[model samples]
Target: MGALVTLELPDDSPIHDLPWIITFGPLGDDDEWEPVVCGPYERPHALALAESVVADEDLMAVVEPLLPRLSADEIRGEIAASRIAAEDDAVQTEDADIYGDYEDLLDDEPGPETVQQHAEARPAPSPEELRAGMARIADKLGNLSG
Candidate 1:
């Protein structure tokens, strides 16, 4: 069994030299259930231990850095910045004419007129001609069977 490892920083250089942790929990959408976290282990050791522990169990193990908890104000500021970035992207998309050149190319196309002309060049076979062709096929099939 393999462990799913997500690293926010380089393996050797954790923030303030903090330790890594192995978190095990349900692989379902159970929001109320809390995950069991074990560690303060070195990065490499945590990963190996996590893999061996979850090999026989039906749980998922995640190996990540154990960073200091964020304050409520910091979280709110991050959310505000994300919202501003999204709004700026929406405004830029609205102001820019992304399809202007594509619309011109569409207009330059010859449309279905050329296809209709090519199809019109070939006339449909007459009823008598079609009957003769069918008769020829039937005769060939009968000869093959004999």
Candidate 2:
């Protein structure tokens, strides 16, 4: 975790944290040659993570697991997948229909209060749905629009 700072409007002028912030972390004791979190070098387990990031595997000795035994529900992985999905902005045939349906049913709802409440009441995806969606989304959305 990080510390929390609270500010009151009564302050003369509250400047945001310069909008952009760059943070650096010190390396660990045993990690002298390696920057586990980040650095100029690629990840220590680059060969292993190649499964997730690399295009070809034969170049490497063998395909390796990036981070075995991951919880699968970790927020960090979710965030990364979300970013990748965004970069793959291509759309699927069904996606437009899905978006239109969502907009019509929710965005164009009859009442503001009703739509707001429905938004809050929406349920999280079930584990099965999560796994299925992840499998499909991990494909780089190659089937989506160009």
Candidate 3:
């Protein structure tokens, strides 16, 4: 038996404003058979029509809402944005791979003195400090909720 399904869209979606269509295709592997697409009808009407069509033939039906077409400028802008993002990612990858001058390498490897200095510079917070920080965070969250 052939099955029928409708594509559900959210109530606020723009697609719900547009007309719906019913697409019928073979249930089995029938490459020679072409899909039959019918109409710009109301959602309810499309579902009814699809049900009737599916009953007769061994075909699956899908009721879908049409989407608005994108303008040429919109397409170009999207492509340009994608290209820029890709280029930026490539640049970042190349930068990460590069290890600078010998001085830069020497600076990255912290000597015993440097490591000791770093440890002294940033000591762990005291218990009182931790409690105060948590209280402050709780106050901020309470304010946001209220």
Candidate 4:
């Protein structure tokens, strides 16, 4: 198994010397970091953190420009993508409150009553709607090259 590592600051470490990167997204209603990069950190650590985190649809990261690495356009694109993702998550949260847990109906030995309740609830978006939303997100993320 691969050894798990965390990028936390040393306990009570002074803030100035320990420059690090932060990757975060909106959770519930607040913004929060998913992974924090620190400790003798270099460009490689920032790259690795970015790679690990890009899988999340609504997060972005920033490290101090150790050597003027990222261009202005690149940073603008990242900001746009993160904003779009945050909007999507907000919509999804509202939808979930309305729809409840649709997947729960698929569990083993689900009661007929429960199934009926799910069936009667106003349905979530169709697959086509989901595809459309994805296309919109893709169109919004101009700087992200697949």
Candidate 5:
């Protein structure tokens, strides 16, 4: 069973009124967990929501058993793997600068312009769909608890 923890924030934009960052994790396999992000949100808000999800009684009940099996090194490795890599951008920029006037070199031959076809926008999920998804998550947690 997979666990989900979401952080949501309100926005004025009609396309995305409530943006969200969802952590779908604690999967039944060894795959690394990553957040499903949409719209715009602050880092602090995401952290707060994750903390709240961790503190939830039912979630904790489902997660507690898994905690004991994890070693400190494993936990650190997960953190390192999941963390964002802003540091790499600096290294990439430095490497590009190694070839003096590299930016000018690329301008010599501009690639052909490609036309992108935009897909038609779809409507948001119905309330029933949202409820069903939540119910499914609850069921997974319940099953794990037993």
Candidate 6:
């Protein structure tokens, strides 16, 4: 199975509309390298802009506004749960008050109801959901331009 890759990056401004070539890692002698022009590349221009953004700083600031809206969906898909442990911890801390409320409720009754309800109520979405959400967000973002 192929791994999924996501890069939420800034646009290639000041260099926008410029053509580029896409290539994979080292190719064998028998295998010819595939090079596609900017318009025909499988991925969108935003991704190329993003990749170029990582390699170049001047383009980063131009796409700042688009980053936040796409970050969550991409984070969910590309970042492993283990990799985001600290962020998860921070998120838990942000919801500490709710946790405290649950603690208070549990303190009143050391029973299974609280655990069961919480487990059943809380939902962890599948990867496909994340992909769809990200695609939707990307489409919305792509639409904003003229």
Q: How close to the true structure is residue 79 of candidate 1, measured as C-alpha lDDT?
A: 83
TM-score, prediction 6: 0.22
* Colliding residue pairs in candidate 1: none
lDDT for each residue of candidate 4 in 18-102, tens digit (9 for 90 to 100): 3345434433335544554443344456557655665554554454432221344555688899999999999999877976766
State the number of backbone clashes in model 4.
0
* Candidate 1 lDDT, 35-121, residue by residue in tens: 899976777788788888878766688887764424445556878999999999988977896745455544465645543334444
* C-alpha lDDT values of all predictions: 0.68, 0.37, 0.74, 0.52, 0.46, 0.44
How high a TM-score does candidate 2 get?
0.20
Best prediction by lDDT: 3
TM-score each candidate. Answer: 0.40, 0.20, 0.45, 0.27, 0.22, 0.22
Which of 2 and 3 is ahead in lDDT? 3
Off by over 4 Å in 2: 1-119, 141-146
lDDT of 2 by residue, 42-117 (tens): 2223323433332332122222122222344565677899888876674553665554545445445454353333
- Compute the lDDT of residue 38 as modeled in candidate 3: 86
User: Residue by residue across 25-139, what tens digits does model 6's lDDT show?
Assistant: 2223443444222222224554555466345321221122222223455567556765688788878887875545455544464545543333444455666776698679668
Measured with C-alpha atoms, the lDDT of residue 33 in candidate 1 is 60
Instruction: Choose 3 or 5, whichever is better by lDDT.
Output: 3
lDDT of 2: 0.37
The 10-residue segment with the lowest total lDDT in model 1: 114-123
Please identify model 1 stretches exceeding 4 Å from their true place: 1-3, 8-17, 28-33, 69-146
Name the 10 consecutive residues with the lowest summed lDDT in model 4: 63-72
Lowest summed-lDDT stretch of 10 residues in model 5?
60-69
By lDDT, the better pick of 3 and 4 is 3
